[model samples]
Target: MKPALFYLIFFGILSGLLGCKKDHVENVPPGQDWTYDPTPFEIKAPASFPILNIPVGNPTTVEGVKLGRMLYYDPVLHSDSLRACASCHSQERSFTSDPPVLPHVNLAWNTSFLWNGKVEGALEDIMLFEVKEFFKTDLEKLQNHQDYPKLFYEAFGARTITHELCAKALSQFQRTLISGKSKYDRVLEGTNWVFLTDEELNGFDIFFTEKGDCFHCHGGILFTDNSFHNNALDASPEPARSAITSNPADVGKFKSPTLRNIELTGPYMHDGRYETLEEVVDFYSEGLKTSETVDPLMKSLHLGGKHLTTQEKSDLIAFLKSLTDTAFIADTALASPFH
Candidate 1:
């Protein structure tokens, strides 16, 4: 074969291969050597849980999660240098600090975010808002950090640190915050010979059945429909989802948070009004206030509430407490890497 023709054919094939490559490779910094090999990670969930939908561009990886975990607990992301994603979300509380702050567990399946569902779409979408708008992350700070640049490069192969990369790393770590091993999960899986007490069993019945009328919004394996509701918290309460939808009918509507780890997720409700599970139960039992936008699922609203007996409330509280996963709270992986 002619030498000229051979060279032309080889170069054409090489260009084609480079063009066809899907994985993006970032430029390496001068005097620095780096490899873009990231260890793939699979998120673990219960058998009953649905498959987590990971974004094609951002696959979960060990390096990415490590960087993200550091970022989550580090105060570097905040302007004040004293707050972080973990400032409000602690692993011990199942990722929720108090009322108005929803748990970050099982968020891979969440279609919306925040108490009013202000942020919609995938986990990446919410993280984008959190990184760019909420956190106002200073890229220059990350770039100037002694360790972050190397960590970011190792995780994302990006020589430059941007909010997008930060958000992606944060999302990667948050996606691993799965919480499906509570006592309720054991009952479903029939593992460890774990069984609910009689009182808790009665509470479970009340929760799932119409007796307590709790299942309509808080049912399912996640213990939440991931939808907004009023639940008649007040007759003319402050606007909630309405702020997002701009619909008067959405007034007082708020996302029905997952009941998992409910024992530690209070002060209950969006306003942090109710301090204990007892108060939350009492409100649902006889303290309901009428509202035009109140959810239709609150069938007992007319009678003021579910009207559960005192013993039933105790039983229901027992069942709610059973949802707490002690293992999740103590998992060292979820704890602050700094500590």
Candidate 2:
């Protein structure tokens, strides 16, 4: 090679290296001051949902949300430190371990928590029990951990970590969990979307009409009235709400959980009795058992359920599967924050 050409190549390579260095992005710590121009959080409500209601005390913040996301996935919140809230309310199964539990959703508007609606408290308060009872969190590990103290300080302006701060951060993170980009949402949103299949449309009709009568309980944008009812699952489900409230009316009643991601959440019912959507559909179609405290909406009980045909049952199952949001469970943002 010519001397001049060799020199030119060397300089060109040096320039490329400089350019690459300049283009590389650097990791930076987020702003920490809780009061200084705090980052704001808001939701883009789906077509069916109204404005999301956030608690004034726990206004969402970027730092707080990040902290909450970390805490949510961190097993350090558990006694075993091998289990986290995500162990049960994981993303893959729509934030629920199995059928009976509903995936976490827009709880900013929720009036109750848990299966029986016995937990009547702010969304943040749920974490208090989760840490104490469900997860059996160890406060010593949290307080002594190198990263937790700093995270707690940034999120709550406290140098020391506490269960309340943990709950607050969790609540902040959970409130951001909004599912509205399903195929159905796109159909409602409009554009060049495929129309619902004939079977799905028929199932929708049955669900909304008196024949199916599903709309009354698990209806609306969130897919639940968020009310309690004796779904006629039993004369009384064990650890029954009746035991807690001493109200006979509360017997056999459980919170009508959201069906937003019903497809992924299966083994339906509080006891996870039915393993598949087929069994669940069949139950509503022909297997309505009479319970003393059955909700009035169970009008079909006097007869024998909707008596949906086999094809109709399949169609209804297809409609329920449409509620699954692949993007939601696959979102990296909702995954374990440790990585």
Candidate 3:
């Protein structure tokens, strides 16, 4: 063939091959793409906080956190439609309700979850329990919903929502609930121009010293060691950690919840036995009920407790209140999307 004619035929074949690629795009339904890549969301935490161990398979994304926040507040997750994760965990109360419900703040650092440590491991592990065992979420409702299908698709690259995906999404949001802006944290940073009162300072001393004996389990950046302990709440308390461990020594042991928002997360302790911070102080001061499972850290059990004086009790309570991070409880991002 002549040079011009040969060139035309070769170019025509190349054009035809390109046309085939366009056919696949044409075959796809409107607005539907085969590839799904959500935007990565970086979690912000304080300098003193430990590095988060996010699951490789379930990284936090902007879309995932948004979906998770909605799921967290929506009552639709429950079969009765009368309760939501937010029902027991309210933001105003530092994501906690009356006792047995712990605050959600700084959960990213926790290895054990729940009052009794029934679930342990990553945040996703506890979230799975929340989705499957706690909520018993019906996938059919989510699949049929007008918003969830699209939300799931954008968040997880899947239109079919499953319990596992639900758990992962919830975990993403929970991981972002960092609470490190309290007065105590400000004092630690030494840059926020915030200082504790004389009473709070005295209480801090008591808390860190053997006088209060609180630091043994409640110390750390997160204000909790994330371990189970039988704090001598009762001589014969109900089975707690034992239920999960099946060990007699574990009985009456409960997880040490974060005190980041201790002022707001009241009805204190595993059973909500104490109504006020004063009562909680009084119990540790002189009312400890010793038992076989009492934590060794409760060294003052022989003396009937810490025997904190009336002024000391007041000061200790003042210090715990210093941990209330107003910024965390009022963050609009963590609040209910519906609200």
| Root-mean-square deviation per candidate | 8.2, 9.7, 5.5
TM-score of each: 0.90, 0.85, 0.90
- State the weakest 10-residue window (summed lDDT) of model 3: 28-37
Query: lDDT of candidate 3?
Result: 0.88
Q: Candidate 1: give its CA RMSD in angstroms.
A: 8.2
The candidates, ranked best first by lDDT, are 1, 3, 2
Query: Model 3, 1-339: lDDT tens per residue?
Result: 899999999999988988976886688643354346799999999989998888899989999999999999998898777899999999999998975497888888888898888888899999999989888999999888878888888899885789999999999999988889988888989965689999999999999999897998998788889999988889897799899889999989999988888888888888798888898899999999988999999999877799998999999989999998999988999999994
Reference-based lDDT, each prediction? 0.89, 0.78, 0.88
1-339: candidate 2 lDDT, tens digit per residue: 999999999999999998776555332233233233447766556757876767778888877888889988888888887977787888988888864565686676687888877677788767677766787777889888878777776666676567777888898888778788777777777748556778887877887888788999998888889888876665444546786689886777888878888888877888799999899888887777777788899988877577888988888877877777898899887788876
* Candidate with the larger lDDT of 2 and 3: 3
Q: Candidate 3 — which pairs collide?
A: none
> What is residue 201's positional error in candidate 1, in angstroms?
0.8
lDDT of 1 by residue, 34-132 (tens): 667899987888889886788899999999999999999999998677899998998877788864588888898899999899999888889989988
In Å, residue 58's CA in model 3 sits off its true spot by 0.8
Which stretches in model 1 have alpha-carbon errors above 4 Å? Answer: 1-31
